[model samples]
Target: MLSQFMVLFGFFALVLVSIVWINKAVRMFDRLIGDGQPAWVFVEFTALTLPGVIGVVLPIAAFAAAVYVVNRLSSESELTVMQATGYSPLRLARPVLVFGVIVAVMMSLLAHYLIPGSLSQLRLRQDEVSRNISAKLLSDGEFLHPAPGITFYIREITQTGELRDVFLSDRRDPEAPVTYTSSRAYLVQEGGGTRLVMVSGLAQNIGADQNRLFTTYFDDFSYDISSLVSRDVVNLDEVAFANTLEMLRDPEAVATRTGTTYGTVMSQTHGRITAALLCVIAALVGFCTLLVGAHSRFGVWRQVLLAFGLLVGIKIVESIVVAPVLLNGALWPLLYLPVLLGLVLSGLLLSIASHPGVWRRLMGRGRRSAEVAS
Candidate 1:
């Protein structure tokens, strides 16, 4: 059973990861390809994002595989034969429990190690790519919207890489729109960001509310493009990029380093731990929820749906727990409530599956008492 569970888990996990990876890759391609990036760059960037995607898909896949495998066994009468052989529900679930533990350990490794490393590398690469403004952002005869409310255009690019007839419009401030036109400009890397140094440029500012326009002419002017492209100040790290050990070792220091709070850092550290444990809870929920029902030739569609509903409920509890924990570091332990609840629910389901005759006898007695009363 453990072997079967592992095989099914791998199959389901691969299928889900492929679907998610494709969707993510398509969007990433659309964004990077438009910036004149090469096919290899596109592929590498997409590949770097896979570890984070796999971390998210692992638990869901484990649950799905557990439900499918358990239902398949039940439908084939294998589960019934095992029960007849005096195998209790808890005994039958031993293999599945081990399978869940294996999945949980894998998830822990991903959440703690692979995801953070890959994501951090991805961010650094993205920042590097963004800093190469001449190659990525500037294109001759094309209107480019690098950021919301900002548009740039270059009429021609000289062999020396100088931009000719540059036009820029900034409408980030709704009340004031600024437009700049330059006869010539050069993109220079400065202070870890791209700067457009324009010569012989005229800047025009229009005020929407006051209905006023102001024009300024200058021989040289500069504009920074890093903030426009959503690139963090180069070398600045975020909490998400920090490893679990770092975050846990000194959450306060991590918070200070990442420009976040202790609550956020501790939440992230504990969240990763609990997120890994959720894989085990999800597997148990899927297996035990199905155990609530007796065998049926028609199929266990109802039980499958019930298992899904339970999983959803657990996730809902997780969402509810996250908000408070994020607000207060002291509430970090609340994150594990969903796992505890799942264990309790799974235990109840196993008890029901184990003593099917006891429940039937109680129902029969109730029916008899009702007849006598009537």
Candidate 2:
């Protein structure tokens, strides 16, 4: 049972992560490619995002694997055979609980290390890419919008680093939009700033009266374009980029760095712990939900559906229960409500399974009510 659960969980996690990663990769492709970045940069950005994606879907995959393994065993009568050999529900659950723990460990590793490290690297790479001026402005024969309200184009470049046939549109000041055309342009750096120097250029703009076009011809012109492509790398201050242990050690430091309150920092710390614990709850709940039904050749599909609903319900409860933690950090322990609820529900299911007569009588009562209504 443990082997089956692991195999299915691996497959499910792979499929779910791929679906989500591809969807995000599309947006990454547009941003990187539009900025003249290479294909490898886009790939790296998408790859760095995978750990978080895996963390998000790991619990669901574990639950599906558990439900599938349990339902299949029931359909094959292996579950019944085991019961005939005096296997109590709890005893039968031993392998499933071990599988849940394995999944929980994987989630914990992701939450604690992989996700935070990946996010930090991703932010660093993004800052480097943003500050790559040549990549942002060096594309020839293609109009580039490096910043909003500005368009730049270069027809060709010489082997000696001279720009040819440059066309620039500056609509940043909409009331006085201007266009500059030059036969030759050179990128110059002086006083720790970059500028575009155009030789033999004509600048056109609307006249003050707004009734006629005005053009000014110059032998040399300098335009400051450093603002277009050079931006300071914003600090990576998100709660997700910080390790949970760091937050626990000094919540005030994390709160100040991330620009969040003490309650929000504590919420994030406990949220990571609860996220890993959710994997255990999901797996155990799925297995125990199926165990509540007797083995049947027809399959316990109803139980499988019920288990899925309960898993979703647990997630909903997780979000709802965490609201208070965000308000008061001392209430962080309440974040475990979803896990506790799932365990209690699993225990109830096991108790019902251990007593067949109780389940039968409940089913009997349900049937009598339906018959009376008919």
Candidate 3:
């Protein structure tokens, strides 16, 4: 059973991850390709995103695999045969527990190690790509808006990399809209930033208050292009980039370094730990829920819905607890409520499955009472 669960878990994980990753990759592909980036860059970005996706979907896949394997076995009467052989529900659950533990280990590796590393690398790559302004702005004969309220157009580019017939419109300051035109422009690098040096350019400013125009001509002027294409500075000391150990060991230092509060750092750290335990809860809940049902030739769709509802209940508890925990570091233990609820629910299901005859007797007595009343 453990082997079967492992195989189906792998299959479900692959299918789900591919579906989600492709959706995200499609949007990223358009953005990167539209910006004149290469195919390899898109591939690299998509690859870096896979660890985070897998971390989210692995527990779900584990639950699905357990539910499916048990449903198939029940439909085939294999579970009935095992019960006839004196195998208890608790005995049957041993393999499922093992499978859940294995998946929890995988989730642990991702939550503590792989996800943070990949996120940090992705941020670094994004920083480098965002600052590459020449690729986005150097195209000639087309109007480009690098940032909101800024329009730029270049008529031609020389073999020596000089831009000709430059047109720039800066409406960022709505009260004083400005436009600049120049016969030629040269890109200059100074102080680790790129500047457009326009020779013999005319600057036009329109005052919205008085509806008046002002024009000025200069032999040379410098325009800042780096600021237009640059993104928010990536926080090198982001708390999420650190492992859970580092955060827990010195939360004060981590909070100070990342410019965040102790509550936020502690929440992020404990959140990872609870997330791993959720995999175990999900699998146990799924298997135990299905085991509560009797033998049926048709299917156990009702039990499936019940299992889903239980999972949703767990999520509701999680959503209710997370906010307070995030606001107050002392409430960090609230994050484990979901896992505890899941385990308690799973145990109840197993107990009901073990003594299935008691429920049938109670139902029969109720029917007799109903018939007498009628």
CA-lDDT, candidates in order: 0.88, 0.88, 0.90
List runs of model 3 lying over 4 Å from the truth.
139-142, 145-150, 155-165, 169-233, 361-374
Tens-place lDDT per residue, model 2, 1-374, is 78898999999999999899899999889988977799999989998999999999999899989988888888888888999999999999899889988988999999899999999999899888887766777788999888899999999978887989999999988788899999999988867777899999999998656667999999999998888864665788988788887899999899998998888988888888888888988988999999886556677888988998998899899989777888888888899899899989989889888997988999899999999999
Tens-digit lDDT string for candidate 1 (1-374): 88889999999999999999999999999888878777888999998999888998999999999999989888998888988999898998888899989998998988888888888888888887875666556678899887789989999988898999999999999888899999999988897777899999999998787898999999999988767765457764788889888887889888888898888988899889988889999999999988887778888999999999999999999999988888898889898899999999899889889887898898799999999999
lDDT of 3 by residue, 46-84 (tens): 999999999999989999999999998998889889989
Task: Determine which window of 10 residues in candidate 1 has minimal summed lDDT.
Answer: 227-236
Ranked by TM-score, top first = 2, 3, 1
Q: What is the TM-score of each candidate against the true structure?
A: 0.78, 0.85, 0.82
Q: Model 3 Cα displacement at 162 (Å)?
A: 8.2
lDDT accuracy of residue 238 in candidate 1: 86
Clashing pairs in 3: none
How displaced is residue 327 in candidate 1, in Å? 1.8
